[model samples]
Target: MTDKRTTAPALLCDVMIQIKQRLRPLESQEVLWDQAAGRVLAQAITAPVSLPSFPRAAMDGFAVRSSDLEAASPEQPCQLQVRGVAYPARPWPGTVSVGTAVRIMTGAAIPEGADTVAMLEDSEVSADGQFVSFRRPSPPGRHVIAVGEDVRAGQVVLPAGRVLRPQDVALLVALGLTSCPVVRQPRVMLLVSGSELVPPGVIPKVGEIVDSNTPLLQALIPRDGGQVVEVLRVPDDPVLLRQAFRQALTKDIDVVLVSGGSSTGDEDFCPCVLAEMGELVAQGLAIRPAAPTGFGWLNRAGTLLPVVLLPGNPVACLVAYELLAGRIIRHLAGRSLDLPHCQRTAPLRESWSSPPGRLEWVRVCIEQNQAVPLRQRGASSISSLVAADGFFLVPEEVTLYPAGTIVTVYLFDTLSGQQF
Candidate 1:
């Protein structure tokens, strides 16, 4: 266990890899383009047809040859016909050739004979319906959208691994994509096991704490694009634990997370349950506040469900999510959790210490451009994280940092409105 302190992040990272290897990137399904934003693409999507499949009008004006406008300025005017030149749709073939022009609206298909567009502002309609006049020369392709200008027919408009945004949805719609291929959201089962835990809103009769991990994990999992298929808060009863675990697995769930009961505490039944069910892949990571995090495989009737066991402490839970579950989620979503690309520099506003073994995840806030440590340090400080702005990692070699030391603050949440 002591050796794990130095090797914890790596060991936890290995557990992340192990679970990721067992789980599959979600399957693909068709979702309406308008509703597809924030969903991951299952496969590479190429344009079904050339965007602007036909040369189309980009403005509500007359389609005319550029040469007509070349000579005509505000002083000089060019006259064209309304009937044969432009119509609501493409006029007859050879309708507006060379000197001729057609009236078109925005998004209307360009006529076969028209090569340019003359804006209405640059032109005026005569007293008669057959006559149109423009004061300026229209350039070639003016106000005209060229075929395939937006997306080529065979082009990979969006490659795989694209997280659909609102703008992407609009583009897909413009390309006539009613439904898009999106990776299926994995169903996650979050099970919190503790005998000393009470449900929320329950009056605490001394020594009883509400089980915050259940709700926190339930919310966190779905935020990563996975569906929380089940949430169970069973006491330390082994029978109830097994029953709840089985129930969570009974429904289709991709991942199973048993919260708390990982340490060598008196009522820790999670390890015993793992032994009775299947193989324990790894147990007891060597890290502060989250040292008891565990991971293993649970076989129920020969079906293996990758299980991630995190410590009961709220901070430990967060760290487990970052180093373990978060990586798996990012990987499954076709992303990488590499060394975060960020400035990583902030001034420490407070002092903290950890033994020279585990990397300390110190929560701090940036005040007046300074990184200030939060009020909590031990594993049980639940309220301390709420007051902090961001966190920084103290390498295993470090013991403590005095205030005013310049350190790299690796932000996990939205500190300074940054994603890093």
Candidate 2:
């Protein structure tokens, strides 16, 4: 028999911990290094060979032995014969014996006997290219980079579980890696339920609303490393919703996101359907504007698959996704448990009030070091989310705050136009 539940709201922090403990990471896969950006590293990466591999010049200067010019003065320039010119990545092919110097460019290998380099401004090359004079003396090892200076072979470069950034991919390529091992992206199946909902690009008739949740979840799921494999729309009928859940259980899906129909109203069938198919882990959360958020698990072929029921309101759905569904998606992608966001601290432009029972998240915009609260037209307002730069959380312990209150704003635009 499936375990069913309808109980008191769960504390925000406890539910976060529970979600972390319940999920397991997916298997790793091999992908090309160029395609590994935004993916989690499955194994620690080590340098295959030391960078530079040999000693080279770091500046466009004449290679010389320091002792030859130690006693030489600017007025009495140290005169030396220029044996040969060394271009980048090429050596002079001969040693700089006493009173001799090699004209070298940046990144050129040092001659066998040269121990230092003098800048071009300090040396005057003769028109014949056979002689050069130094006005300044250079110490040994100046402007010279030794072998293994940047990275050493067999040394760990990046640890496992690191989210690959653009620079990380460049580093891996520089280390001669053509491919990388990363955790597989989780596949999601989205099911939207509502009798009044219509797809985008279609004008809704009277008493009907455009289906925003489907497109919203489609854009967000992949940003967090989960790919939406399918999207299906179902009416408010329990029979159709039950059939959708049964069909989803038979397919290969990492998680099922059921949007709408999670409330206690008569049309809400997500909780009842989840209870019949599997175990309802929790019914609600003690959070403002998102109290209808819930999650559960369904068993198929002896494997437990997670099912997340989301509220219909766009803003509430966004909050529920970030705090709950996003966590599981990141875990399945082998990412770190910490939720990442670009944070900015600012003072409130006006006073704000909240209830004491549930945690609250307020959308706000930053203007000249102040967080101006956006006008909330209920949780269904998509314009408010777009106009706001980020949001601030209000704990259940605090109810009111005066103007100029400093708060940290968690930015949602960190990964805009880029894969996370």
Candidate 3:
């Protein structure tokens, strides 16, 4: 009978500040370097040994003294005795003398007394394998990788808080690291509360819809470096919702996400339950499509678990998750707090308008390097997101963006399908 919506909605910036102030990264754990990709580094990794610790050939070449080829030319080719051959794992035991050369493969240790490597293409070896002839002068250090050419011992190769990529894993392996210290992934519990919702496999009857939020969150949680430990579908009843909240807190959860029941409707009980169980820090964000978004802290044992109350609408739920829940999860996983989107400044293909006081996320398709605003702007339009390549935010103060206005579009697919 009473409207409980806050007349003055909290700014998105304020809510984000509160969330960051209360949460911290999870404890670090040691995992094998082979399994460290996509995990955030918990500590700085210093190189124990220099990469290419020994002087090695950078290409398949003949290791020879630079002075021997100093006067070699097309008209007066230089001839040198072939001392031995060197492979990557097998180095030539003998040294390169003034008139001799060692046939060396890439990555093979450079034979002693050799200051340059004449590429195999530039040298001709005799059929008898006794002598090699070069027509071009070779410079010192040419085609040779000196000791510590790539990484130096005791140098910080990977810094703390960095998400390990495939290349990063390779570097760690090159550094001779068997295991790496990475922040543990944040554990999450998803609670989808609605009476008219059915599981994904079930065919929804009249007035009932398939619960898409669960699957959406399931996919997104891991993308933001979170592990969903439990998922529960709660009815609209406040009692059951409250029980679900209690049960989620009992588990080892870093964050609890409640999709639906966040608005100020009669069945909307998430805000009340949060207030009763812990402290409701934010409610009714000043953001379009996700205005009912709420944030709170639940005291479980001695820890304060973050609880995000997202609107039931599929699009609204997604927006809230991207702006709030995703940030929380990434922070707890020791990753950057920035949104996992590659942003690019592009001009709008058409004019767009938003409410003067609410931040709006406008789904747009990139066409001809321009952001084309979609027609489906409803909070429940999942199709809009499906068709969108990215979205752009309109500031709370601005109401309209004229056609061709430059705006930053956050791309959904970039940097391995996420943030840059």
Candidate 4:
């Protein structure tokens, strides 16, 4: 029996909306503070105690009463006795009196009755080591870090749904938290099917080639916050493909990725298998280089798992994964569904043309503040992606971009050698 399917491709925006409506972030779990980086916070964190919970010296100076130095200047320096010294974790035993100053180091606690700190450079110590003189008067609270200056108690330092950074881990450690509650990473199962494909390090016969999609997806899955739990290689045979799909669904996984057999060729069986086993929400996309991408929901016991079908062509597989599968994985991992790239506006170096009614992603390299389109633009050309620095999209209604037109380029990596 022939499988019936929709001929018209679904709009990219509409398919994304459907995915957002169906997928929710996974449950939360506790992880050590060191492992919390790059994980989304599932709960808000409040400061239990204020940062720098004590009044401390901001620099190496003497703590003094502001009134003692108010009328003192270079001509008439104020002479005060040096009572004691204060070091980090060691506070002066006595308070600062009306005519005495305490020698303090940076980050040391200020003594009681002292409201100002005079820098060592601006003060002179007597040869007898019994007295210190201030040449300039300092105002009250000068060079002093007051209580709760950096963060106050009961303040929310981190909120839910926030993706933690390396600096964030430091903040949590400073807050005295050993562990943090974060959304669990999504688990993924990959099924790569192609009879003409061979594994890496294997010599293929005349009609076969190495399977690149499996390794590509394996690397990409974790980069997008999902963990690859299993990988299954299936041939073009329908029974084996169905068995692999069934086996993947039975395992504990949040999403399934089928890397080949998504197009309309005679050997293409992903769309048909998915339709027979579950509901195919979208069979094709109205986007260039990845129009054969498909999305669906599979029922595992009582849970519905999201599954994506990526094209067999290397470039198309990458495009479809970044635009569709990546978003789904990020959503389940409690991360933003937006594209993970830095965008910059630049003028086109040459005129570019595209067919109307389909959105196209054009790869280009930034040259002297201009977006220069690459020459290798085929779906199977993986070298184009490597040679290009970034890409810009042409909207469905627009057909042509004239030379020197300002366009936004989404960088594959950051412009300043930083990762987004």
Which numbered prediction scores highest in TM-score against the true structure? 4
lDDT string, candidate 3, 1-420, tens digits: 233656577898998787778777899999998789999999999999998889999899899999999999878889999988999999999878889999999999999999999988788889999999999989999999988889999999999989999999999998888899999999899998999999999999999989999999999999989999988999998789878988987898889999898988888988888888898888888898899999888898878989999999999999999988899999899888887888899999899989988999889988888889998889998888988988999999999999999999988886644322
User: What's the lDDT for candidate 1?
Assistant: 0.73
**Which pairs in model 4 have colliding backbones?**
none
1-420 per-residue lDDT for model 2 (tens digits):
122445888877887676677778999999998799999899999999988777789999988999998876789999999888898756778889999998889999988899998889888888988888888789999999988898999999989998899999998998899999999999999999999999998999999999998899999888888899999899998899989999998888899998998878878888988988898877888887788988889988887788888999999998888878888888888876555677778889999898887888889888877888886937888999998888898898999877999988888888555221
Model 3 error, position 392 (Å): 1.0
Off by over 4 Å in 4: 1-6, 415-420
lDDT by residue (tens digit), candidate 4, 279-318: 8888899888899999998998878899999999998999
Clash-forming residue pairs, model 3: none
> Residue 36 of model 4: what lDDT?
91
TM-score of each: 0.84, 0.91, 0.93, 0.95
Which is superior by lDDT, 1 or 3?
3
Ten contiguous residues minimizing lDDT sum, candidate 1:
1-10
lDDT of 1 at 197: 87
Model 1, residue 135: distance off in Å is 4.0
lDDT of each: 0.73, 0.86, 0.90, 0.90
